[model samples]
Target: MEVFVEPQEGSPFCIRIGCSDTVLEIKAKIEKHRGIPVYRQTLVFDNETLDDELDVEGCNILDGSRVWLIVAPEPPQSAKIELCVGTLPSVMRLPIEVQVNDPVKRLREVVRSLEDVSLERVKLYADGTELEDGRRICDYELQDNSSVDVRIKPPKFMVMVLPWKADLKVAVEVKQLDKVKVLRKELEKLQPSLELDLPSEGYFFIHNQSGMDEDKSFQWHGVEMGDTIEVFRGTISR
Candidate 1:
């Protein structure tokens, strides 16, 4: 008998098999035709998930009948490794259990969740070496119960400053905790090197599309990394 298997994704295809063939045999044929692993396939007939041991005829699956094929997601890593994560300054040690293949960023997220600290402020290190965000824990060759250090560092971001009537655009590094006025001073300090004719603090105002308040910190204004701050030679009237 020939059966039509409709996958959750992609076009439906037909498979020719014996009526007495088991569902597992049908899955094997599908693996041969589609290269999808048999274990990842879940076949549903008449709104029921077919057991692997059930035969096509026993399930009342007739020739040309349509069956739904659902591809299960990849299972999580089963091998869990424990690590001793310590936070600096406070010297708080936390025991974290994570999959061996988990990314370093995932570890940081776990720490952030357990400690209730901002993910941006969290940094993980092992043996004084900073763990990169992109690499997996297994890539570091870290074994079970390895000692990892977490540090809370103030996050800083760079902003592009386009001076009024000038061709040069300077990139200034600023911290989230710094007030908006501090951005002006940092730009002023670069006046000699960049040959920019920026007016003194009060005379000129920085605009991020809208006029930014000098008294407010960058965090308060929702200024993020790589944002552009335009400088205009005019004061914002209250």
Candidate 2:
């Protein structure tokens, strides 16, 4: 059986385990290797999570069956550690849980979009069978070593037009503490609160700020000078 598993950022990408192993064991393995937060991670099979005190067998993962463990990204919104205080726009996160013998479920979390954000609402199967209930499944059995692609819609915002003198092109990556601050300052120009778009993920990380507070919402995320970020830019006159 060929199983493909996708773990979110700061997560273990792939692994193989016997049906005999419990979900707890999987968590232990992740901690031993990756040291991920146990509480922050969720083990999902057929794209669903097991409820509290729920056993892996409840989901009925068969021999050679594949499972996905998703570690949700932490909300970027945080109060400033500096003396300044401010609020950032809230990002949305949706958790999905499904039961065995049930149809497949798709979870969607949208920051600015209202729709569920799924390319396909229904999960179709031709050979054996399929079952689902309001994003919950309890009966349809999944094939061992199978693969399912889960996609969440990316948050959309308006493009930022910086009047800065530097000739900026599309930058795929940005690294440097000072550089991030310089970019955030440009965002501040737009309105002390603007979002930037990146060509890719895992762009950068910032060390904690001890003196800042009001700018709490303004996290110092690494930004390449060329990467494009979207903002509302508010309504424009016709």
Candidate 3:
């Protein structure tokens, strides 16, 4: 039977070995075939990333199974979620709503600091309630009906000075696991919204590169108040 493998971009051929070959042997061979080593190349079976150091002894293989070796982007799933940024943020309070496709996360509450230049923070809450001083969004899950408020705090000096002049809002969106997986591709075409005026303060259209919202890209050209949203079939080259 013929086996299908996900070919890395620009690679000539995919490495195919017998069922008896261990993952180690496969890696060694792939390194020989390609310029990269087994350790460097990420191996994925059915979209699940495989650990390179682990032995292939317990990894049962079948005849038609496919293993792809690609120069993958960093942690594909997390990037998938954050790439939806500039769009509305999902709610992430505790006792969160559960969904079948909810990306399983160890997130709880976030006391965001709009106070600093670098948005990076350490991971605070792992189980839900506890807080790690400087953590990242990757650590948290945005649950349905849960509002993730990025509280903006003012900068502090050496002494205790009251903080003021910081404007922030509790930006929120509903999170449903099942809803996310369905947004894996781009929309063939977007539906035009009713002739409505998108206020400069309330709205700016996000690019529908991932087909998540099925909304088309917003063009600033000729767009004015009381104009209708134009829907088109947007395509990506790469």
Candidate 4:
């Protein structure tokens, strides 16, 4: 019978085994193909972990069945570390459990995906020094419970002149630390020259942009520098 085995962190493949093949036998096949030792291999099916001595027949593992394989993680040479992710606008703190051997780029990818921030904007720092993506977590020599700050670079804010008499729009270089109210104030000063009226209560919103709360900074909105903020009249709706 052919069985499908998927690794926890690597590629998945199919292997052929007889009905009487033991779990250890399956581990041996995986070890041959993936180089993970049989002793380190763990197999689970239907949410139940299978014992090493269990055979395919006893486990009731049929052909075309899928098995989840988790190879034991490498021991940490140093102490286990915790990563704290801080993203702008919301100033969210995400605590992540990580091993020393994990790649720094992997953590960056996680933050980038979670915050919806661009790869260039995602910055990881340990101590006062910036952490490079190509390095490993161990390279930082971070102690247990050490906080890693995830800062985002400021995206450019494009203020689209609403009631726009012209096709052109004005672009503003804004920092992630800058608030939406400040952005609106800047627009109020600039819009007069374009015959655009930005009322004292005027606010900015980007259509289809998630988390466009005017009270929050651009970083919180996951907005890119080139993205436009639609001009809205009156106060911002909650």
lDDT of 4 by residue, 1-238 (tens): 9999988887789999889999878888888888875646789998999976799999999999999998776554654677776754455677887777777888888888987978888898876678766456765666566777878876545544333333566676667656766766676677668666554554455544433666777777666556666665555446
lDDT of 2: 0.38
Regions more than 4 Å wrong, model 3: 1-4, 11-14, 53-57, 72-238
Q: Write the per-residue lDDT of candidate 2 for residues 1-238, one digit (tens) a residue.
A: 2234457554335455545556665665665656664444577777678543444566686655666767644322331111111112222333323223232333112211334444443233313233222322212223332322333333332223332232442222223333333444444454323334432322222223222222223324433333343322222232
What TM-score would every model get versus the actual structure?
A: 0.40, 0.26, 0.25, 0.34
Model 2 TM-score is 0.26
| Candidate 3 TM-score versus the reference | 0.25
Off by over 4 Å in 2: 1-4, 10-20, 73-238
Report, for all candidates in order, the number of backbone clashes. 0, 30, 10, 1
Which ten contiguous residues of candidate 4 have the minimum total lDDT?
157-166
Candidate 3 per-residue C-alpha lDDT over 44-160 given as tens digits, one digit per residue, 9 for 90 to 100: 775666654344434554556677767633333333332111112344333333331223222322122222333343123333343233223332443333333333222221111
Best by lDDT: 1
**Each model's C-alpha lDDT?**
0.83, 0.38, 0.36, 0.72
Ranking by lDDT: 1, 4, 2, 3
In model 1, which regions exceed 4 Å deviation?
Answer: 1-76, 155-182, 185-238
Clashing pairs in 1: none
Q: Give the TM-score ranking, best first.
A: 1, 4, 2, 3
* Ten contiguous residues with the weakest lDDT in model 3: 157-166
